[model samples]
Target: MVVGATGTTGSRVVARLSAAGLRVKATSRHATPVDGARPVRFDWNDPSSFDNALEGTDRIYLVPPPGSPDPAAVMLPFLRQARAAGIRRAVLLSASAIPLGGPAIGQVHKALPDLVPQWAVLRPSWFMQNFSGNHVHARTIRADGTIRTATGEGRVGFVDAEDIAAVAVHALTDAQAPNTDLIITGPQAVSYGDIAAVLTEVTGHTVTHRRLTHESLRDRLAADLPIEFATMLADLDRAIAKGAEDRTTDTVQRLTGHPPRDFRAFAEREMRRPRSRPV
Candidate 1:
C-alpha cells in the first residue's frame, strides 16, 4: 500500500511498483484513479479508512501529511492498525533535517522500525522538484522568474523525487530489509543561486534568487500557512543558511544501482516536458 498515493513521491512510487509487476494498493484522501493499482480512500484523521486500505497489503510506503505539527499524533494510530492488520514492512518518508528522535517526523522515524517487522526510513534532502511543483518557490519562479528564500547561499544536495521513489521501491521490495536510515541526496550540492542559474539556462528566462530575512520569509509563508508552521519553515531555511544541508550521499546510488540525477539533469528534463499552467 502507498499512503498519500497522489503525492509527489508517493505517486511515483506507486507507478514504479506497479510497473515492476507488483500488486499495489494506492491510497489518498479521495478515490483518485491510479494506473495499474487499486485506489482506496484513506485519511490520517479517519480510522475507518484504515481497514480498507490495509486489506491484502503486506508492505506500505508511508507519506506523512503536510502541515502536521506532530506527525506521530496523526500517523501512529494508523500504523498500529496496520500492524494489527498484518502489514510486515514499511518505508517512511522523512527529511534530512529531522534526525531520529529530533522533531516532527523524527518521532515516527524512531518508533517505526520497532513497530513493524521490517522498515526503512528515508531522510531525503531538499527535493529538486520544488521548482516545478505547486510550492511557493515554484509559483514565484513561474510568475516572475524569481525564487525567494531565507536560505542565503547555503548549498544543498537536492535529491530528485524520482530517485527517492526508486530507492523507496527497493526498500519496500528487497528480500532483506535495509533496517537502517538512508540519507538520500543528489550527486552534488548546489546553492539556490546555482539553481537559479540552471533555471535560466534551461528555461531561457532570467531566473534569479532573492534572499530574505528569516522574519520576512516567515511573514510571507504565514500568508498561506499557519503562523506556527510558517515560523517552522522559516527556521528550516535559517538552518539551511547555516549549512545544515550542504552534503551529498551515495545512498540512492548504492540502493538503486544508479547514480542519483543532478539538478542540471532535472532542469533539462523539466524544460523538455510540456509546461503546465502554474497553480
Candidate 2:
C-alpha cells in the first residue's frame, strides 16, 4: 500500500510496485486511478480512512502531508492502526535535514521502531522534482531563467524522485535491510549556479540563481502561503545557505547498485522543452 499515491513520489512508487507485479493498493485523496491497481480513498484529516487502507497489507509506502505541524500526532495513531491491521513492513519518505528527533518527519521516524517490526526511513536530499513539480520557485526559475532564494552559493546533492522510488521498491519488495535511515543523494554535489548552468545548456537560455534576503523571500511567498510557512521556508533557505545540505551520500548506489543520477543529467532531461520568460 502506497499512501499519497497521487503525489510526485508516491505515484512513482505505485507504478514501480505494480510493474514488478506486486499486490499494490494505492491511496489518493481523489479518485485518481493507478493502472492495474486498486484505488482507496485516504485523507489525512480523517482517521477512519486509516484502517481500511491498511487492511491485510504487509508493506506500505508512507508519505506524510507537507507542512504538517504535528506529524507524530497524525502518524503515530495511523501507525498503530497499521500494526493492528497486520502491516509489518514500511518504507517512510523522510527528508535529509530531519534527524531522529529533528523537526517535521522526525516525529514519525522516532516513533516507527516501537510500532513496526521492519521499516526503512528514506532521508533523501532536495528532490529534482522541485524543478518540474509544484515548487513555485522552481517554476519561476524555468520561466524567468532566474531562481531567487535566500540560499547563497550553497551546494546541495539533489536526488531524482525516480531514484528514490526505485530504492523504496527495493526496500519494500526485497528482504535485505530493515530499521535504518538511508541518506540518499545525487552522485555529485553542486551549487545552484551549477544547476542553472546545466539548465542553460539544456534549454539554450541562461538560467541563474539569484540570492535574496530572508525578508524578501518571506514577502514574495506571503501571498501564496501562511506567514508561518513562508517564514519556515525562508529559514530553511538560511539553513541551506549555511551548507547544511552540501554533503553527498552513497546510500542510493549502495542500495540500488547503481550510481545516483547527477543534477546535470536531471536538468538535461527536464529541460527538453522550449523556455520563455515568466508571463
Candidate 3:
C-alpha cells in the first residue's frame, strides 16, 4: 500500500513499484486513479477507510498527514489497525530535522518499531523539488524571480525526490529490512543563494534568494497554514541556519549503486521536462 499516492515522493514510489511489476494499492482520499495500480480510498482522519486499504497488503508505504501539527493523533489509530490486519512491513516517509520521538511524525517513528515486525524510516534532507516543482519556492521564483527563506548561510544536502524514492523502493522490496532510520541526502551541501544561482542558470531567468527573519517567515506562512505548524517550519529554518542539515551521507549511493542527483543536475533535468515552467 502506497499512502498519499498523489504526492511528490508517493507518486514516484507508486510508479517505481508498478514498473517493477509489484502489486500495489495506491491510497488517497478520493480513490484517485493511478496507472498500473489499484486505487483505494483512505483518509487520515477517517478510521472507517482503513480496513479496505489494508486488505491483502503485506507491505505498506506511509505518508503522514501533510501540514498537520499533530499527525500522531490521526495516524496511530490506523497503524494499530494495520498491525491487527497482518501487515508485516511499513516504510515511513519522515524528514531530516525530525528525529525519533522529536515531534509530529517523529512520534510515529518512535512508535513504529514496536508496532510492526519490520519497518524503516526515511529521514531525508530538504528536497530539491522545493525550487523546481510546484512548491512555494518554485511559485515565488516564477512569479517574481525570488526565493524566500529564513535559512541564513545555512547549507543543506538538498536531496532529489527520485533518489529518495529509489532508496524507499530498496527498503520496501529488499528481503531484509533496513530496520533503522536512514538519513538520505544529495552529494553536495549548498545554500539557498547557491540554489538561486543554479535556478537562474537552468531556467534562463535571473533568480535571487531573499532571506527573512524567523518571525517574518513564520508570520508569512501562518497566513495560509496553522500557527503551530508555521512556527515549527520557521524553527526548522532556524535550525538549518545553525548548521543542522550541513552534512551529507553515502546512504543513497550505497543502497542504489548510483550517486544521488546533485542540485544542478536536478534543476537541469526538471527544466528539460515538458511543462516545467518554473526553475
Q: Which candidate leads the pack in TM-score?
A: 3
lDDT tens per residue, model 1, 1-279: 999889999999999999999998889999687876898999888888888889898999999988887889979888898899999999999999999997789999999977898999999999999999797789999899899999999999999999999999999999999888999999998899999998998887889999999999999989988888898889999999999999999998898999999998898987544568999
Best to worst by lDDT, what's the order?
A: 3, 1, 2
Cα lDDT of candidate 1 equals: 0.91
Clashing pairs in 3: none
| Order by TM-score, highest first | 3, 1, 2
- C-alpha local distance difference test of each model: 0.91, 0.84, 0.94
Tens-digit lDDT track of model 2 for 1-279: 999898878989999988888888899887478866899988778897877887778888999976675678888888888898898888899988788977768888988888899999999998887877668757887578788889898888899999999889888887764579888899877787787787777777778888899899988988877777688778878888999999998887877798898877887787666557798
Q: Mind sharing the TM-score for model 2?
A: 0.93
Better of 1 and 2 by TM-score: 1
Q: Which ten residues in a row have the lowest lDDT in candidate 3?
A: 270-279
Model 3 C-alpha lDDT per residue in residues 1-279, reported as the tens digit of each score? 999999999999999999999999999999997867999999998888999999999999999999999998988888899999998999999999999999899999999999999999999999998986689998998899999999999999999999999999999999999999999999999999999888888788899999999999999999999999999999999999999999999999999999999998888888643455786
Clashes of 3: 0
Flag regions of model 2 displaced more than 4 Å. 274-279
Q: List the RMSD of every prediction in angstroms.
A: 3.2, 3.3, 2.8
Model 2 residue 15 lDDT? 92
